[model samples]
Target: MRREIPLLITGIVGIVFVLQYFIPHFPFNRMNAWFSDWFSIVAAFAIWLGALNLMKISFQKVFRRKSDWGYAVVIIMSFLLMAVVGFAEGKGFRDQGTAFDWLFQFVYTPLSATMFAILAFFVASASYRAFRARNFEATLLLLAAFLVMLGRVPTGDVLTGFMPEGMRLSAVASWIMNFPQTAGQRAIMIGIALGLVSTSLRIILGIERSHLGGGD
Candidate 1:
């Protein structure tokens, strides 16, 4: 029963949204907006549920001595600390004064920047792994990727001293980004759109209920 009700509701909501792209009538538009607002409220409740699940899982890990559970402790602590400071201080970010502001600006911002900066290293590592030459196609992909990366920086100009006239270095880079690259991106987007449509049709018709908990 717990699983069935939510699945039914989700199916109905997904169908309505899919219809909305084709039907631009007032009823569809209004219904879509109301449904979106309702979804947002429900999403907030789901966030609370997620926070509860996180706390439970982290506590279980601490009890069992799972590998690197201390990191989970840090994750849970950071969320709780931010929640406490935000609520206990005042209302929205506007009213949230001095100390909270300092914490948000300095502490949270620096940690977030550093965390995202670490992703550059991971991206470089992944590019290395993915760029290995196994065949002609793979070699071409690797070469193109190297060109794109080089063209993003001053390195391209240094290496390609024969850069053509009337095309500034940045303009050459912009052409690479805008023309063939964007066309490829558009093609990929079209494929993604089709996949989304098929998956959504499946969900709307009750072919997918995996998001619901195991049935009792």
Candidate 2:
């Protein structure tokens, strides 16, 4: 019952939303609005579930005195500290200059920027590995990446002064990102939607039992 009902709800809601886009009237519109509220409630519950999981994992690591226990402690503390500050400042939401806002701005924002910068270095290293000149296709990809990077940075203009006035390197860069990449992304999204539909139908019909703890 637990498994079947959730899937039925998902399939029904998904179909209703899709149909609502075309029909745009009556029960479809009302159902869409109601579904929006329902989604919000579900989202809040999901946030709680995520927080519970974080606490569970962090506590386990802390108790075991794992290698990164200190990081876990910081994450847990940060979440709870933010929540407390948020609640203390405003009844429903945090006011600006409240303890929560201050921590978010000063600590969390800087920390997140640092984290992003660190990830950028990792990404550059990974891209360097992926774009290694093994073959013609890879070499083209490397050249494309180099061109895009150069077009964005000031140094690119300085280095590429030899490029002719008629040259449209920036247009080439934009087209590369928008046309080919966008098409690829749209294809992936279509595939994902189809997969979700298949999975939802299977769940509703009780064919897929993988979600159950026991192997299906």
Candidate 3:
């Protein structure tokens, strides 16, 4: 009954949402907004549940003196510090002068920026490998990427100054982006929309029960 109830609820909610898009009148019109509110309420509870679960694992690690337990201690302290500050400040927690705002700007922002900066190196390394011309298709990709990158910079225009206006690298790059890139992007988006419809129908029909935490 436990799993059956959830599956029934899922099927009903999915059907209602799908119908609400096409039959936007009377009860269906209001159901979208009504369900959205319920979704937000559920999400608020989910956030609390997630925080509790995180603290539970962190506490267990600290009690066992596990390797890297010091990091868990830091996590607990940071979580508590932010939560306390936000609660104490109440409605003004996110205001410019508030401690929560200060911590987010000075500490969180810098940490996030540093993480992304580190990731930049990995991105560049991956780009280098992808841009390598090992085959005909790869060679075409490499040339397209090179032209696009060069076109965005002033150096490209300067280097191609002797060439005719339409025959310049920048013109070639713009054509590739507007025609080839846009077409590819549209094709990918269509494929994604089709996949989403299939998966959604499967879930609505209860054919995909993976969300229930086990295979059928």
Candidate 4:
């Protein structure tokens, strides 16, 4: 009964939502809106539950003085600090000059920018190793990347200065992106949508019950 009840709820909700897309009648729209509100409430609770779990684990690690527990302490401290400032200041916490806003603008933004800048170097190193041109496909990929990168900078114009404007590397790069890249992306999006529909149907039919934790 435990597993059966969840399966029944899942099937009903899925079917109703699917019908709402096609029907779009007044009653169905109202029901869909109600269900969406319920989902929002559930999502809020889920986030709280996740935060509580994180706090519990961090507390345990800190209490036991485990390896790298200092980072766990930092996480808890940051979470609590943010929450306290946000609650005490109410909507003003989001306004400029508030502690919360200062932390976000100065501390978080700079840290994020620094991390991304460091990551760019790592990505370039990885790309250099991957583009070794050991095989025909690798050589083609390496050349494509080289053209794209070069065309994105001023150096490409200097290198192609002798060529006609229409025959420049930047023009070729633009064509590659607008045609081949766009087509590839559209194909991937279609594949993703089809996969989503198939999985949703399986869950709605109760054929996929791995989400129920443990069941036949």
Candidate 5:
């Protein structure tokens, strides 16, 4: 019964949204807008659900004194601290000079930046391995990466000054980005769209029920 009900709702909502895209009539458009607004309200509730789940797991870890429980304690405390500041300050909590804003700007942003900076080194190492000229395809990829990197700097432009303006490295880079990059991006987007449609169909047909939880 639980699975059937979810599948029925999924099928109905999926069909409605699919039709709404093609049929731009009054009722369809209005219904789509209404659903979107409802989605926002549902999202707020989902956030609270996520926070509660986090708290529950963190508290369990801390109480059990599991490995890395200190981090779990920190997570719970941070969540509570943020919630307290946000509630105490109300709507103005997000404005500059508020405790929430200061923590986000000084603490959150810097930590995020540090994480990304660390990731850059790992990405560089992976790229080096991937770009090794082991075969024709790999060699071609290596050359393309080199050209793109070189074209992004002033040195490449200066070195290629003798060539015609359109044939310069930077000009070639611009052309490659505008045409090849955009085409590749569109192909990926199309694949993602098709995948989403397939997954939605599976859920609507009750073939996928993982979202309803395990041991079904």
Candidate 6:
């Protein structure tokens, strides 16, 4: 009964949302708005639930003296520090000159920047492997990437200075980006939309029970 009730509710909500997109009138539209409001409210509570779960797991790790327990301690300290500062500052916690704002700007921003900086090396390594010309299709990808990268820089212009403007590397790169890249992106987006529709249908029909934390 526990699973059945939720599945029924999900199916009804999903059907209404689908109808609202096609119908876009009266009851369906109103129901869609109501569902959206409820979703927002549930999302707010979900965030708190997630934070509590995080803290609980961190505390358990610290208490058990698990591997990387020191990181758990740091996580707990950071969470509590930010929560206290934010709550103490009331509505203006995010405004300039507040402790929360200062921590976010000076501490969080630098940490995030450093994380991304470290990731750049990994991204470059992955790109090097992925751009290797192991096959015909791969060779084409490598050529496209090389052209795009060159065109983005002043060196490409200098290298192609002897060529006519329309025949230059930059022009070729621009054409590739404006046509081939846009076409690929649109195709990928269409594929993603179709995938989402199928997944949504599965969930709506109760065939996808993974979200309910059960095997189908």
Q: Give candidate 1 misplaced runs (Cα > 4 Å).
A: 1-7, 63-69, 72-80, 92-97, 149-180, 213-216
Q: Report per-prediction Cα RMSD to one decimal.
A: 3.8, 3.9, 1.7, 2.3, 2.7, 2.1
How far out, in Å, is residue 124 in model 4? Answer: 1.4
Q: Candidate 4 lDDT, tens digit per residue, 38-91?
A: 999999989999999999999999999999999999999999998898898897
The better candidate by TM-score, 2 or 3, is: 3
Worst 10 residues of 5 by lDDT: 207-216
How many clashing pairs per prediction, in order?
A: 0, 0, 0, 0, 0, 0
Better model by TM-score: candidate 1 vs candidate 5? 5
Off by over 4 Å in 6: none
lDDT of each: 0.79, 0.79, 0.93, 0.91, 0.89, 0.93
Query: What are the per-residue Cα lDDT tens digits for candidate 5 across 143-172?
Result: 888888889898889999999999999998
Output the lDDT of residue 13, model 4: 92
lDDT of 1 by residue, 89-136 (tens): 776643555567878888988989999999999998998888998899
- Between candidates 1 and 4, the one scoring higher on lDDT is 4
- At residue 75, candidate 2 shows an lDDT of 83
As for candidate 5, its clashing pairs are none
User: After best superposition, candidate 3 residue 46: deviation in angstroms?
Assistant: 1.3
Candidate 6 residues 1-216, lDDT tens each?
Answer: 889999999998889888888896788768867888989999998999999999999999999999999999999999999999999999989999999999999999999999989998998999999899999999999999999999888888889999999878888889999999999999999999999999999999999988898974
Model 3 CA lDDT for position 2: 78
- lDDT at residue 50 of model 2 (Cα atoms): 88
Give the TM-score of each candidate: 0.74, 0.70, 0.92, 0.86, 0.83, 0.88
lDDT of 2 by residue, 80-172 (tens): 888877877778455686777778789989989999889989998999898898999899889888878776776665665678733556655
> Candidate 3: misplaced stretches above 4 Å?
none
Write down the lDDT that model 1 would get.
Answer: 0.79
Angstrom error of the Cα, residue 167, model 2: value is 4.9
